[model samples]
Target: MTRTWTIAGSLSVEPATQRTDLLAEPVAKALAALENHREEAGVAPIDPELADTAAFCEAYGSPLAASANCVVVSGKRAGEVRYAAAMVLATTRADVNNVIKRRLDVRKASFAPMAEAVELTGMEYGGITPVGLPEGWPILVDKAVAEAPELVVGSGIRGSKLLVSGALLASLPGAEVVEDLGKV
Candidate 1:
């Protein structure tokens, strides 16, 4: 199957490697994430009412049960290398102290600023994906997120988003499905 990932102006039609959910690898992966909801094609609601993560899901007519994949700020004073990838329910936050903080062995871990996050991933802060990240970043995904029928991840760059399955995310390049990631 040929998957065509629509970008800002052009389209990406990669050869069939994994299931071609879309022409782009990211879109394909995103489509793959929606395996549980196979009947419903997990396409980004192009005309999103809002830009925030929650707004996207809600606008797409989702049950608001979608998870937001983010690069969390961790370690004392934040901005530390302890940057981790975390996916939490749109309704819940990560448990930092009891989970990621101790797990990363940091004195404190707060959210890294959007500017910093964007800088690190070479992608817009809101569009960071787990598949392609700078080396040595931590991925602390919530176990509950992986169990989700369909989770929303990044599309490499922010121009678009990927709605993939938790199982698919677990099998992604650098994704580490864990329940230890924390939220504030």
Candidate 2:
């Protein structure tokens, strides 16, 4: 079956490989590295003002269920810090306090500061995506997100969004499918 993405909204979808300009540097570099996987991705432009999940969905006509939110979280232990990206559906929240904390094997875990996350990921504050995260950072994907056919996620920039499959996300480097990662 030929795979087609959901872009029924006002956004114009284009092959991510050809629209590298729409992606952040890190995201573009990451996608370029994935020769086979890049073909499975697409990009769409959006107003930066509507980068937020709720606003983007409402303005672009994408449903919350089909959108995935990527959040950066960090934990400290023994003078060391561990950072991970959690990908969950917009309809749910990442179980940061419990599931994520346990998954990272850290005693305490919480959202990473905006400044820190932006500096580290090299992506805009509200446009961080799992595709091009810093090496060594684990990507924890919610089970529901992993099973999704297509999902609207950040393009590492506020001006655009990435269209990708759950399997592609789950196959990203250091990605792990976590059950109950998202709590409704």
Candidate 3:
């Protein structure tokens, strides 16, 4: 299927392969691994100062709905911590207290500490995307995110962003499309 991109604003992007240097190690490797699958990923370098989703969206003119945020949540079971990455539209928040906690079978589910999330994911705090998360971590992709035609996600670093097919994200290994994973 021919892919259509909805990039706006003044951001200039190139094929993901040519921009690996701009991404974190895990993210670069993940991009390489997806090469055989015909993943059409693109990278756009931006000012680190504008790496946050809202800032990036405003600076690049990408619609907020087309921007997806990846958040790391953790819960404890029998003193063991379980981590999961949740992907939701920028316009909504992940249902951590209810849906996620229930799904995880834990009494409580909360966002992981910044240090823990960054260190474990090997990605920057604001750039912790599901693309390169640690093995065995469930990647919960909200239905809306999986259905978007195009999406702008983190590059695993604060210096750039990744533009890819939403379908591609849903197909990532360990990705589970969950309905109502996000809430207004």
Best by TM-score: 2
What would the per-residue lDDT of candidate 1 be over residues 6-80, giving only the tens digit for each residue? 221122223322324322444444444543433332334243234466665555444455646665555653544
Q: Rate residue 61 of model 2 by lDDT.
A: 93
- Which is superior by TM-score, 2 or 3? 2
Q: Which TM-score value belongs to model 3? A: 0.94
Which is superior by lDDT, 1 or 2?
2
The C-alpha TM-scores of every prediction are: 0.66, 0.96, 0.94
* Candidate 2: Cα lDDT at 22: 98
lDDT, model 3 = 0.86
| lDDT of each candidate versus the true structure | 0.55, 0.92, 0.86
Superposed model 3: Cα runs more than 4 Å off? 1-4, 35-38
lDDT of 2 by residue, 1-184 (tens): 2346664377788889889999999999999898556788989999999999999999989888999999999998887999999999999999999999998889999999999999999999899999999999999999999999889999999999999989989989999999999999
Candidate 3 C-alpha lDDT tens digits along 131-150: 87898888999999999878
Q: In model 1, which regions exceed 4 Å deviation? A: 1-49, 76-80, 180-184
- Of 1 and 3, the candidate ahead on TM-score is 3
List residue ranges in candidate 2 displaced over 4 A. Answer: 1-3
